[model samples]
Target: MANREYLKLDRVKGDLIVLEGVEGVAYGEILEITLDNGLKRDGKVVTVDGNRVIAQVFQGTQGISTSNASVKFAGKPLEIALSRDILGRSFNGIGKPYDGAGPIYCEKKYNVNGRPVNPVSREYPRNYLETGISAIDSLMTLIRGQKLPIFSGNGLSHNELAAQIVRQASVKGEDSENFAVVFAAMGVKHDDADFFRKSFEGSGVIQRVVMYVNLADDPVIERITTPRCAMTAAEYLAYEEGMHVLVILTDMTSYAEALREISSSREEVPSRKGYPGYLYSDLATIYERAGMIRGKAGSVTLLPILTMPNDDITHPIPDLSGYITEGQIVLSRDLQQKNIYPPINVLPSLSRLMKDGIGEGFTRDDHDEVASQLFSSYSRVQDVRSLAQIIGEDDLSEIDRKFLAFGVAFEKQFLSQKTDEKRTIEETLDIAWDILGILPPEELERLSPQMMEKYYTQR
Candidate 1:
């Protein structure tokens, strides 16, 4: 019935297009705009106040003449084209399939934005999404329906680690309805895009993957919408299609940068580091979209990667990100400088949902113990290193001697891994075997007997 009525356009400004005379017009109304060329562009209401709404033109409003064009609001928000057909496909920041593939064979389109999982709707995340990596699974375990951010600095190998997790992570015995990785890369270059494509294809995980890219050469404004579009598609597949989805957002710094650019274009008031004031809530809108919705057969997990500008955690983007997301896996600049591959600095890194996702039958019984032990050992290594700088490694105590070896084993064993390598939960656990070798069996009080016998090979 709402489709029969229409509202007239009041004005159009930079990033803000206004419509007049419709109290309760609502936010994000899907509309069809008949442009001059007779091509109807599909757009949505972006901002609304007392019936006046502003819509962002996804296709770029070049020839959209006010007098010529008619608007038809479908009385709803933007929805995505989603289904099994979305698999192995590529789309722009908006959800229009562009891989030379025809229209998606979908049931129906759903709203791009949806409500977050209610506190009552949330079930305890007991199932472990085994990442097949020692550093992650054995220490900072990733749980299903959890938001775990990867904190990486510029020029680090975070991208490679993200890609590998997509390839290697899965749930045991649930092979059929396992992971579907929704990878969104915003503001990356053509070469970076190509590298991800090639790496994903070579790994043969491209089939279960849906990628929405806003490259460096593309429209910068598109970056803000890119993750939303990817999540839109992800939501459809995970909930409706009944598949566990892992939504990866690489370089959220790029997304934030795009936001700053648009805000500057509009001459909006800037906040810290020239970012918008509502940056935290804006990020929460995306990151919180990930979770297990009540009664839904599938879940959407998030692993958003952010590059701290100048490796500064205090930077607005990574700072607000730390506040919004559950926990972060911080990659170390010093370890990277030492030629370590992942260089995930263990002490600072944490997974808040680790306890909920590990232990008992989910992973091994000894998982928590081994993880805590590793944390203690590595943390002491830092203390030893600082003292060594003051008094040297030679003049250290017996306990300090063990810490030195633990530090080396941590880097060579825990952090470094072949990019081409894919380890199972067992193999990753085996690396735990080598790291625990530095401390004596009595000092390894955290590990259980089966774990000690299986992993603690006597030196």
Candidate 2:
């Protein structure tokens, strides 16, 4: 269909503009709204009902008048130009270059609303992706093509942790040249955006990174498009260029809030916590995009971070995310109070795919045994600490005292690491062994006789 123009504007509601007598306008189709003063704005068709349509202006509807505004349907959805040159470039929330660089010279543009990968074409994710953090690498190992999210709260150090992962993450035996990162920040402040950029640039990893930033002051509608743009670029690089892509979307809560705002504007009924009813399926569209296709040479791994309100894990955002994602890495406020850098509370954290990704051919043969022992020992430590609080510490038994000491060493040495410190898988496992040795031989039941003789005895 040819592009159509309409001079009728029914009303302006919040950031949305309604039009009557609009025909052949499809959902998600782009629109060009020109004001009487010749200032033009971009919008997308959000809701259509026969001859009536509702669209959201990308800039805003502040000065749009119902009598003078002109609506022209672009007959296309929101799209971004994709190419291998997108690496190391910075773009706005809508995928327009903001790095002082000119436009991307590309022959093809991809729709930001990507199609879901068919379940039949998905390959089972295997092989660990190392983040160089002991708490993550040894415990909740991130597998290629897995979607593992970080559950955090306000004022925590998740930003630093995210930047650190981007700088240090790598795949075992994979060439550094084939590894790339796509970082997207939604509803972030100026200072926070600067921190991410400066951290990556200072670490000299910006060359392999693609950044998409949507500041808090920008239009809230743009937040919904930020991650989609990042994912589009990632798919292009991973599937077309054959490069492994790690997509990190920080503060997904902001994106959900944007959706909620639009839903409210459209008078849609709200679900849990005043969010839209389709929160689960909407989130799935983004999270489900991470995987390896059967015939594809590369994969896409997602590490989405969301801050929980009042540290409530049962809140709708994190609750729904846990259901869709493979696993989560939870950050502990209590650990942060103890001066831990990453502050990962490993007790509640897990990686469902770690079993298939580690041991024998992948990581070390002892990786599985060592990880199990650490989990069991740490769980015992928590029980011991609780018991000591009820009774006096001086009255505790020798084994109980050993458990408390092991807990301290585990947190201080194993879980906590400098922001810039990068530990190899071997080094992380070695540290686990050193901490586990504090327990008596009887307490190390998670390890087999062979692993005990090989690693435990040597320690």
Candidate 3:
């Protein structure tokens, strides 16, 4: 294979450049750009139409001239070096070491855009991943190999929740030792990056974690690559090394915005909210990468955190994501206003794989019952509260008043917790029992007779 350098540049649009006289350039092939001033940048071939090749430069085109700049086709796709040593290290979105650890030289290098796992080879996600947060573990349970996203709005505590999950998330059984984390932050602020680093280091889980950060100041092109790079490392860890890898990609909204930016620069037809039409399929490429491979001892579970634009759940980014993922963990602005730390609304949020993962051998025998009863009871609380506003609480029935009280206790005791506090599945279930005890045994209709006999502890 020969590396060919082309000097005939056609056009330059922001970070994208067009080159004619290119032969055999593959889509996603790595390219090297050399400016007239001797500065070099890396780019990837995004499109190839006959002899016309379109490459997106990782570094924006600020000081490059069409007649003077040159491009070299690397004849291969973008790849990241992968090995067991990638653990406990940090890299930029493009997989260059960012934590002062020099370039990683390994025997294996994986394409950043990993090959999708075949549906026939996928194993059912059947194990629990306890995040140590009561609001999630007790209600919307996270399972290994599931793509569960966090739907949040601006100014909510989503970042804190993400950090907490990374800090406290663990496997329940003997396979705990095989757990590792791959965290990717796209278009996040400097302080937010520092917060994640500090949180991970403080929790002492930094050793089992690999981080890829694309800061707000970084080129938008890299934001597009951040999650892919992180997923590549996760695939290496999970499939090759047999470690259960949790990949957390935060602020996917930013990643989508970057995609839209590039689409606009390329003059492509836009879809809903000016996003590209392929948004759904593009996102699926990332989310669908999460799952268990048949006969493989490891799995990849995705916890993508994306903030809704103007808190609109129907926005294209979240709407398309919800369609692809197993379920969503929705944060509440109303609850956040009330000072709830997690602010996870149990009614709207769900874990489709929770049933397959919990009860008996997974977490606890009472987990399913307790979660269902809490949701039912809290839903009634919302109804009673709405009624109280119409006809004052003083005029309401005693049961409605008890429902109101239960709601308050549920949020304070069951939902809200200190940032540093970590609760086991048993503790989360016990808290649910204590909160459900406020209502009469008849009110707990969701629980079975066996569940009631064992876990129901009412006064």
**Alpha-carbon RMSD, candidate 2:** 1.1
Task: Give the range of the ten consecutive residues with the poorest summed lDDT in model 2.
Answer: 450-459
Across 1-459, the per-residue lDDT of candidate 2 in tens digits comes to 328878869999988999888778898888999999999999888899888899999899999889889988988899999888888899999999999988898899999999889899999999889999999998999999999999999999999999999999998775557999999999999999999999999999998999999999888778999999999989999999998999999989999999999889888999998999999999999999899999998999999999999999999999999999999999999999999989999999999999999998998999998999899889999999999999979999998999999999999999999999999999999898888888888888889988888888422
TM-score of 3: 0.98
- Per-model TM-score, in order, reads 0.89, 0.98, 0.98
How many clashes would you count in candidate 3? Answer: 0
Model 1: per-residue lDDT, tens digit, 1-459?
337435345666654456777555566577777755678766666666666667766565666655656677787776776778778888877667767877787667766676676788876666778777778887788888888999898899888898888787786765456568899999888888888888888988899899898888666646777899888877888888888888999889999888787667556799998988878888999998888877888888899999999999889988888887778899998888898877888788888899977777777766788788888888878889999999988899987898799889888977788777767766766677677787888877767777787657766
Q: Give the TM-score of candidate 2.
A: 0.98
In lDDT terms, which candidate is top?
2
> How does candidate 2 score on lDDT?
0.92
Query: 411-446 in candidate 3: lDDT tens per residue?
Result: 999999999999999998998899888999888899
Ranking by lDDT: 2, 3, 1
Candidate 1: misplaced stretches above 4 Å? Answer: 1-25, 31-43, 49-53, 61-74, 175-177, 263-268, 445-455
